[model samples]
Target: MKKMMQRDSTWAGIFLLPNLICFLLFVLIPIVSAFVLSFMQWDMLSTPKFIGFDNYIRLFTQDEIFIQVLVNTLIFTACSVPMVIIASLLIAMALNQQILGKKFYRVLIFLPVISSNVVVSVMWKWLLVPDYGFVNYFLSWFGIAGPNWLTDANWSMFSIIFVFVWKNIGYYMLIFLAGLQGIPNSYYEAVEMDGGNAWHKFRNITIPLLSPTTFFVTVMVVIGSFQVFDIVMLMTEGGPGRSTSVMVHYLYQQAFRYFDMGYATAISYILFIIVLILTFLQFRFNKSENWSS
Candidate 1:
């Protein structure tokens, strides 16, 4: 029995060894090194010097731009997350219904999500140009003058939010569609027998059952929003007076542009904490809802 158990353990270890080695070499080591580096000061060309928590202390207390970046990140995530999630759910509901051209509509919506963010941002920059852009041209008919989107502090973040929502809705819509389909038809039949309308059916039967999916979507969206960079970089470069400067973009600027490795790593850890807290809140809410139900 002992010999057979040893053989089984050996096989299991062999099967897991490759992935475990890769993870340790690629992920765990780097993450741990970054964490350690966060507490030290280094310029890329010099030896790192231990700085304790001074980087974090400065960020929280003395760094005005850091505060602005944090505020912008929070606002961007706050505005875009709910809009994208709800929009995706609605799209999913519509697409999941028995309608003609359902497959085509799904494909059309999903294409942009998988497309390159830089490419989309560049295309939108042209499309939103004040005078010759297609969107402004259409708006000109209404006699309401269009502002410079990427260059105007007032409109820059909003413009980015709109782009983010437009690009991401399709992906989440597909997720929601899967969730909707996973729901049993028997629930709908029971609701029908109870004289439920579409609204009633969705509220009572669909939303409750779809809570798990919603929770998952919420977590992913929040995490993605925290890390948003490409679109901002391509669209505005965190310009228009830094109004659209998200945390990650600010981190990039600090590290590469300003050569502040210690500060950049500190900013990264701040973002890490924010994401961790948001994830915890999402799961806590889900757990509470589950228990209540």
Candidate 2:
């Protein structure tokens, strides 16, 4: 028996070795390197000089742009997370009904999610052009002159938020759809027999039952919103006077454009910390809500 158990353990180890190695090489090592790099000052071309906490101090106290970028990230996360969650949930509910061409509708909605970010950004940029853009042209019919979405600081952040929500809504909708499907129909039937309306059923049955999925989606959306880089970069280039300058985009600029690898690493760590704190709060809220219910 002992010999057989040992053989089983050996086989399990053999099967897991490749994945463990990959995780170490790709994830663990990079994380550790970034942590170490955060304390040093190196511009890719020079040897790293250890300057403990100076990068962090400067980031927090001295760097005005960093503060602005941090605020921008928080605003983006705040606005985008709730909008995506609500929109996804509503769409998921609509899609859950026995409507015609449901699968086709799902495909249409999900196409943006699967499309390349660059392509989406470019398409949206064309659509949002000030004079000849489709969006502005449509607005012109109503005599509402659309602002320059990409060029104006006041509208740039909102434009990015709109695109982000549009691009990712389908993915979150699918998640909500799966959650909705997992819910047994018997609950709804019971609610129906008890003289409950659609709102009542949703509030009492769907919302409570789908809390776990909602929590997961919320956490994911928050994290993803904080890391919003590609869309902003490709669309606005964090321009219009740094209106849409998110943390990751700023980090990329620091690391590559300015060659301030150490400072960029520090910025990355700050983002990690922010995400960790927010995720922890979400879990705490989830636990409290579960207990309360």
Candidate 3:
């Protein structure tokens, strides 16, 4: 038995070895290096010098732009996350119903999710151009001139939020669709026998059962909102003077554009810590809800 167990362990390790090596090389090692580098000041061309907590101090206390970036990130999260959740949930519910061309609608909604974010952003950038763009041109039919979507600071962030929600709704819709489909029809029949109507069926059966999926989707949307960068980069490049500049985009600017590797790494860790705390709090809420129910 011991010899057989040892042989099984050996086979398991052989199967895991390739993935383990890749994780260490690509994920674990880079994470550790980033953590260490967060404590040092380096511009990639110079020797790294240990600076302890100065990077963090400068971030919170001394850096004015960092404060704006943080606020922008929060605003983006606040606006985009809820919009994505509500719109996707409603659309998912609609798509879940038995309707003509439901399959075609599902495919249409999901097409954007599978497409490249870069290409989508580029296409949106052209479409949203204030002058001679399709969006503004359409608005002109009603004698309304559209605001400068990317160049106006007031509208830039809104444009980002709108585009982000539009691009991401499909992915969340699929998740909700699966959750809806997983719910058995027997529950609805029971509700019907009890003289409950559509609202009662939805409230009593669908909502309660779909709580887990909703919770999961909420958490994912929050994390994705915080980590968003590519769309912001391609759409506005954090332009209109840092109005739509989120943490990750600013971190990229700091690390690669300005060569402030240490500062960027520190920002990255801060982002990680923020995300970690949010995730923990979400889990705590879910646990409490479960216990209460």
Candidate 4:
């Protein structure tokens, strides 16, 4: 029996080898290399020189732009995540209500999520133009002056946040809709037996049952928000005056534009740390739910 088990294990290892090789070559090797590279100073033209913690030390203490980029990234994520979650939740609930043309509405909303971010950003850049754009043109009727949505220092982040939220709502809404459907009809029936109204049903029954879906959406949205770059590049280029520069964009600038490989790797690790902390916090909250169950 022991020899047979060993034979089976060997065959299993043989079958897994291809996938393991691919993982090592593509994912694991790059990650390990990046970790090592973070401690070395290098330009594309020169040999890498070991610099220890100098790169990280400069990122925290000596780099003003890095600090600004961190702040901008945090603010953008903070503003965008909740807005996307709430908006998507509301839209999902409405769409799930057996309304007319529900399929059409779902497709329309989801189109933006599937569309190219570059194309959307370019189109919106025109629509958000200070004078001739359709947005400001419409605001003219209300006697309210619409600031340059993409170009103004004060409004650049807000404009991008609004567009980002709009673009993501459809995708997240589908996830929420699936969750809403998973909720058994029996739960609502039980609530009705107790004379629970809509608010009570949502507060006590919907929220608790939907917490798992919320957790999933939060994690995905947070990860995507942290990596926001393409839209910023296409729309504002981290201007007017770096008002819209997120962390990933700054990393791109450092690594590609400035050819500062060590500093870029340091910033990437900082992002990794931030993401790790947030993920841990989410799991901590999730564990409470598990314990209660």
Q: What's the lDDT for all of these models? A: 0.94, 0.96, 0.95, 0.94
Better of 2 and 3 by lDDT: 2
Error of 2 at 261 (Å): 0.7
Q: What is the lDDT, from 0 to 100, of the residue 9 in candidate 4? A: 100
TM-score quality measure for candidate 2:
0.98
For model 1, the run of ten residues with the poorest summed lDDT: 284-293
Cα deviation in Å at residue 221, candidate 2?
A: 0.4
Q: What are the clashing pairs of model 3?
A: none
**Per-residue lDDT of candidate 2, residues 1-293 (tens digit):** 99999999999999999999999999999999999999999999989999999999999899999999999999999999999999999999999999999999999999999999999999999999998999999999999999999999989999999999999999999999999999999999999999999998999999999999999999999999998989999999999998999999999999999999999999999999999999999999999999998
In candidate 4, how many Å is residue 271 off? 0.5
- In candidate 3, residue 279 scores what lDDT? 92
Cα lDDT tens digits for candidate 1, 1-293:
99999999999999999999999999999889989989989889899999999999999999999999899999999999999999999999999999999999999999999899988999998999987998889988999799998888999999999999999999999999999999999999998999999998999989999998999999999999999999999999998887999999999998999988988999999999989998998898889988988
What range of 10 consecutive residues in model 3 has the weakest lDDT sum?
110-119
Question: What are the RMSDs of all candidates, in order?
Answer: 1.3, 1.0, 1.1, 1.8
Order the candidate numbers by TM-score, best to worst: 2, 3, 1, 4
Of 3 and 4, which scores higher on lDDT?
Answer: 3
Clashes of 2: 0
Candidate 1 stretches with Cα past 4 Å from truth are 1-5
**Which residue pairs in candidate 4 have backbone atoms (N, alpha carbon, C) closer than 3 angstroms, thus clashing?**
none
